[model samples]
Target: MRTLTERRLRLVGVAAQRAHDRLGRYPASAEQILVDYQGTTRSLIAESLVDAWGNPVQLKAGTSFDALSLGADGAPGGEANNADILLSELLASSAPRPRSPEFAGLQRDLADALHLQFQLDGIDYSHAHWRNSDLSVEQIQAALAGKPIPPKRHGPENHGTEPGADVSRADRTDTEKAADALFGALSGDSMLAKAMGFMMKMLGASSQARAMIKIVLADTLVHADAILQAQPAPLAELMKVLTVDRNTQVIHDLRAIIADEPETRSVAVFYGAGHFFDLEKRICSELGYRHESTLWVPAITIDINETGMTAAQLKGFRALMRRTIEQQLKQLD
Candidate 1:
């Protein structure tokens, strides 16, 4: 395996190439958005491989895998990660909190619902697609009604939406929030609230999606690694899922979505940049997606060493990622 330093350098290269391809320009910023595993379903591989890339994977994608893993109970909750990623293997094998037989049925049902929904639509139904897509609106209704939907929407840009303001959490309603919370434990006030609202609406009367600007946290890698070390489940399964090429499955699902919902085909998925591999003969070439605004971030080059994230550190980093958001908010001078 490459050392953390080498990985950083590689990450730099990936970012550079992606930037060139997307904007035909270079990045103007050095900071990378730290979210990858949150709000997305993963097999195991994707979780362990989060940000493990030496460089930023890809800034954007036409199809993304954004979904939230329910909290320890396998249900959504605040103060818990939406993705099942842990710093080490131990936590992986350990049973999740809600792995209860009762909830498992519903969980499986939802998964089945999601799987079949995607299969029916004949399109990429990564949770991100469902949550982010305009198709999701119709998807909820159609899924409830057991009726066919219209065509999926093209990539968001084709719709001509303003960049930052495009997605607002407030769109979800309160009932949706409960349903979403019922589905999975979405940490972070905003994520939990948003999921709850949307779910409520879909199930019946949902609340509007909420966007809370502050993520209060401050952690270092050391602390993160410790937390991982203490948890004793092998996370190999999750890791394997992340590294594998899932586009074919994604494609199959996307096609299914299209077949079922031909009218409201609009969907969007957001996930870690690493999923898009520029490697020769990789999925990216096969999947015609473009990257924009990838170039602005500068790559951090370092010699390859072992991964630097300890349990405490990983937690700390996550905390930092969250807290940093708060810091920025505090800086509104």
Candidate 2:
């Protein structure tokens, strides 16, 4: 069986490669590597990089970058697994490579599918696709500093409202605060809470579980969009936190905009698909509006042909994904 030191070395190599791919250079420090490559759904905790014997791994970059797990003795050289674990050895055959054109096309297809549109009461509303990757380092820093960042340009095909005309739907700061509170509640001093927290960490750290989680999160994001177009019942819990309160604020903004700006005959409230169901209900029932037309845009397409997986395998994978999402939703409840 692979030792903890071996697994951590592999993780460091993978994270370094990913950071290199994104930033055009390898991370200068081990701590920064995790920060740079952190995804919306996955995060690499600093403590996880420690060696099997509970020593901090030393990371350096020179002619070639290397991470050293100074073995059980916490000394330089020793015998067997006690020998220093050189990450360079693992990275030798694992250099970073640019994504293929086919892979880029698949990502574009996925992005295109994520953008959806709806026409209600003679106004066009589009679900804007926003991923954590869309924020630049400068923008993120500015946000942290409490400075207003410029609106993200969603490209010409977004078909959303004009920059100045668009009403803000949600406050990122509020969302962050809510998340902090929830995390604190989950990790409280209570024994049951601690056990639940431990289980969550264990599941998150498992390689198989992490891989399955990535697939499920991807599916949930796309499925959320599709559900918004068809029926959004499955997304009830997600919508409650993500959209309802924020969308209510949006409706209030719309009310003021309509009353103050008489010239504005049509208005668009651009938001994520998770918000659409609630928005639609509010507009039709409260605002005396009705849906005139609907447009379905492909946001993400998982081409089984390109995946090289058998039909049965794909079916089983999808079953696992559904169960994962269901379990997550239950936990949220």
Candidate 3:
């Protein structure tokens, strides 16, 4: 027999598909689907439509609809009863796959650099990768339409006192003020700036981090290209933050599971190679776990030497990346 929650998820999937069939597009809001397709009275309160866990379901519209219940704990991701319930999973035929380009090369390189090991001693581990929310091809295209990207939900508020805002103060050195001015100007309406902004949004970058990347790009690409040409590990630090910090929540979730359920033997944290080092430290030192064993799985296979690029070209690319990394580190300092 289907549980009440499972039955509700089935109903949501049916209603979402019906709304899509009628309107030729997914409804923008859950209430719209409920009213138009499920025959719910317009006077029905939207908030009343919640899962068995009493959390309001989240709805996202794309080429198809996604209705999500955060599950028993009402958090983003979990296992067992707390695992997310997705309406699209119930109606897999009506769901569309995301069309984002695979970052196989980047993944491979980062994996090697991090020296990712797959073993944990005395524990049976399962593997799972952390991923961003699904976005359809249509959603990606819409985001790249050059419109101002919406600020991230739950992101920090802008109070006008953001970094570089005090560039013109008399107490500041001329060079310091000039640097600040340059950073500010990079955020202007120039074509290059606009293009950078668009690309950042397409990658689902946070607004604050995107702004920093723009400043670094402006400072390095515009003025110090030769210096970057001399470096071999450009952008390494920035890449670390982009790849590692973004998955902090995954670590938190793992810790929560271990703490809450003592019987959760043989836990598997299958994340990107970049994430394993920090996660290992947390798991062992903080959680009283020890490294046991690892299994190496090739996520991608590639040989840089096989690529048609000349030796000089490859060296130059590495140098440029190094310089980019150095500049990002400076900003942190």
| Best model number under lDDT | 2
Candidate 1, residues 54-138: lDDT per residue as tens digits? 2222223222212122223343344533233221222235343332232233333333322222122223435432543233343
What is the TM-score (0 to 1) of candidate 2? 0.34
lDDT per residue as tens, model 3, 188-297: 34465455445544543343433334333334544343443343332332233333443455565666677797886655455546556666777687678776544332
In model 1, where do residues sit more than 4 Å from their true spots? Answer: 1-234, 242-248, 255-266, 270-283, 294-333
Cα TM-score per model: 0.20, 0.34, 0.28
RMSD of each: 23.7, 21.5, 19.8
Clashing pairs in 2: 110-300, 113-298, 113-299, 114-299
Residue-by-residue lDDT tens digits, candidate 2, 1-333: 126677688777666666665676777776677664334212333644688788888887654567888788889999876788888776576554443332122222222233211122122223352222233333332343346654443443333333453224355344344443443443344465556545545655544554444455577775564343343333333234445655665676677777898987767566767668788999888788887655333333344554455889877988887777667655554
lDDT of 3 at 199: 56
- How far off is model 2, as Cα RMSD? 21.5
How far off is model 3, as Cα RMSD? 19.8
